[model samples]
Target: MATEEKTLVEILEENNLIDLAKYVNYVSASQAGAIATFSGTTRDTFEGKTVVELRYEAYVPMAIRQMKSICSSARSSWDIHSIAVAHRLGTVPVGEMSVFIAVSAVHRADALDACKYLIDELKASVPIWKKEVYSNGEVWKENSEFMDRKLELGKTNGSCCRRNVKVETHGTKSCCGAKVKVADGAAAEISTSDAGTEETI
Candidate 1:
């Protein structure tokens, strides 16, 4: 079985900005033919509200773990070379990047799709939460897409796939939609289905 280890996941400290080039450079590989990226920035407005900024928080340890699992899942699903993901904490003004992702692969399709998957999964499942601050007030927000994904998971597999299940090395806990193998100092993806009854990393 083939495995990749070139993955970088970081939750930036308070007031630290995301370095766009750092991640892109990390994923740059000689064997890679394509590089894809996604940047989540705070917009100036939301639903007729004048936004001032956005604030983010997270359980740092678990956030990094979940991010690694997500990257591992992408590697199993695509032929990718390297992956990089970064998320910002603290106040982020409008037009500033809050999240950035970079993916490199031997083909454009792999990089493109993996890039999309990384951001989607991060937004939906990561421990990091965000609050939107408007001119009038501020409120913590949840991703609606994540809620939808949870409903879908409930309809198909059990709650294990959608909720944050503690991943055990040899124990009987599953993961978020992917069969993750926790071994060799990394979380590697093995399969995508049968997550309800089987033990996933």
Candidate 2:
């Protein structure tokens, strides 16, 4: 007899706009009592600067791989039934969504926690890079999650298990023991990890 998989994970990275409804529907199941989601959207202003739009680039293959790993980790930590993640590349206008995640579980806690974990880990560990474009000028912004992870790596001398995660830092030759170059005119994507509070429905 063939053994069934314990959890189902779905990941997508594309240059086209993401369809939130599709993901929300995909993770919905009869057995799932709760569905938690995170939608990362572009904001209008940053640091008091007028923003035009945001740009995102990723090492697609590696990004998807890391996302899968994060999903697996979430499954191990929680009794999640399914997960669906989608990230948009290219240009995402202000007030538009850049990333979306959905998680389903038998209970609300597992769904909510796994949804949050998926986004946080994705921001912290994934190789996707974001650039913020302002009216006057533009700059590549680093996520707080990424910066914290970088600092933790330095403190442990890159000896930690999560040290293998590579983060891109501005004006630096190395991040998390990996070399990277910061590109100019880069816009900041979604940096807030909270994604609002969990809603029961």
Candidate 3:
């Protein structure tokens, strides 16, 4: 069971750039000609205004599962050696890293290509969402960018949801106790037995 699952999923409460680079170093071997890594960070400004901080939220389980699936998919599609992906959550200030993707292969071309695809697919299919906070207001980045490609892949693969995991309308309580509603009804309510009330999904 453990072997079937990728061991790269991690919760990064701190900076991702360093850890990501570290992971990249760890995954790359001498057998590989090249190792590629991409890191995304919060900029001080966007569209001509000073940016403050950014908040990221994700459907945790689904996001991690999707990342693993992506790595597996890339491995199948390309001649990749090893892959590691890490994304940061919670409040991130300007210049803080947001996401990291790395891929190593025997050839530089495959490594670069797979790395690009990994980041693009991560942005498009993975269930992670980011909120950009600016001086004036905040905006939620569209989740639609990844939907079409994911659906197409689902059709090719027969389904998007992995085995034993069904996509439905569900809500999840965040680590901070905030409830996030899922349109697919696949989320579940998480509450402690000692709590006064059970949070609704």
* Model 1 lowest lDDT segment of ten: 191-200
Q: What TM-score does candidate 3 reach?
A: 0.68
CA deviation > 4 Å runs, candidate 1? 1-5, 151-201
Candidate 2: worst 10 consecutive residues by lDDT? 192-201
Error of 3 at 95 (Å): 1.1
Model 2: lDDT of residue 187: 15
Show how many residue pairs clash in every candidate, following the order shown.
0, 6, 10
Per-residue alpha-carbon lDDT of candidate 2 for residues 1-201, written as tens digits (9 for 90 to 100): 222223333323333567788778778887888999999999999878887777666644455556778888998999987788877665677998988999888899999999999999988877666677767655656566766786766753432222242323333221112112223332122121222111111
Candidate number with greatest lDDT = 1
* Candidate 3 overall lDDT versus native: 0.62
Q: Estimate each model's TM-score.
A: 0.73, 0.71, 0.68
The lDDT per prediction is 0.70, 0.65, 0.62
Give the clashing pairs for model 1: none
Question: What's the C-alpha lDDT at position 99 in model 3?
Answer: 82
For candidate 1, the lDDT comes to: 0.70
Tens-digit per-residue lDDT, 1-201, candidate 3: 111212354435422333655667655676777888898888999779677777677665566667777787888888877677777766677877778777778788998998898898888887666666667666655445555665666643533322222222322222223434444433343322322112211
